[model samples]
Target: MEYGQPQASTGGSVVRAILSLLPDWVEWTVLSLIAAWLVSLGAVQVWRRIQYCRAVRAGRPIHAAAQYGQGRGADCLGSYAPPRRPDADGD
Candidate 1:
């Protein structure tokens, strides 16, 4: 290459150019999605904390084996069961 010639585009320069062309709404949409995800995560944590507090107040065993299905599968608890999809099996 000649000394006066321009250099080829690097990965960083290409990415910066692409990002500069995106509309403002695209950035806002991404920020909104991130915010929603964070809020949902916080809500889940709060729900867990409330449940833990209730368990303590009710004198429930937090680590009891029976709570997690004793010696059988999780479905053995009867309170919780996974929904079966009709198309799960290739019947």
Candidate 2:
């Protein structure tokens, strides 16, 4: 209340200081997680491309869905009934 004297901060100043620091920590953690995810995605894409190139060089047609039996089921001619197992019910 004196002239030329600065006002002193109360207990709220400590709370404000802690609150301000919290955002910086949260921002850094989120940034690190996003960066890691992007790097992993890029690595997976490169690996897939390498595999595709290798398959092409081996004189075999590279069919992505071939592993799931896409065209191979045409011989059934609509008579295909999906195989059922008795244990599929988790009993």
Clash pairs (backbone) in predicted model 2:
none
Candidate 2 lDDT by residue in tens digits, 1-91: 6989776587768856665777888867876998999999999999999999999999777875655434355446566756656675421
Clashing pairs in 1: none
Cα error, candidate 1, residue 36 (Å)? 0.9
Candidate 2: deviation at residue 49, Å? 0.5
Candidate 2's TM-score: 0.46
Counting clashing residue pairs in each candidate, in order, gives 0, 0
How do the residues 5-46 of candidate 1 rate in per-residue lDDT, one tens digit apiece?
A: 777679868966776788889867876998999999999999
Top lDDT prediction, candidate number: 1
C-alpha lDDT of residue 18 in model 1: 72
**RMSD per model, one decimal:** 11.4, 14.3
Regions of model 2 farther than 4 Å from truth: 1-22, 67-91
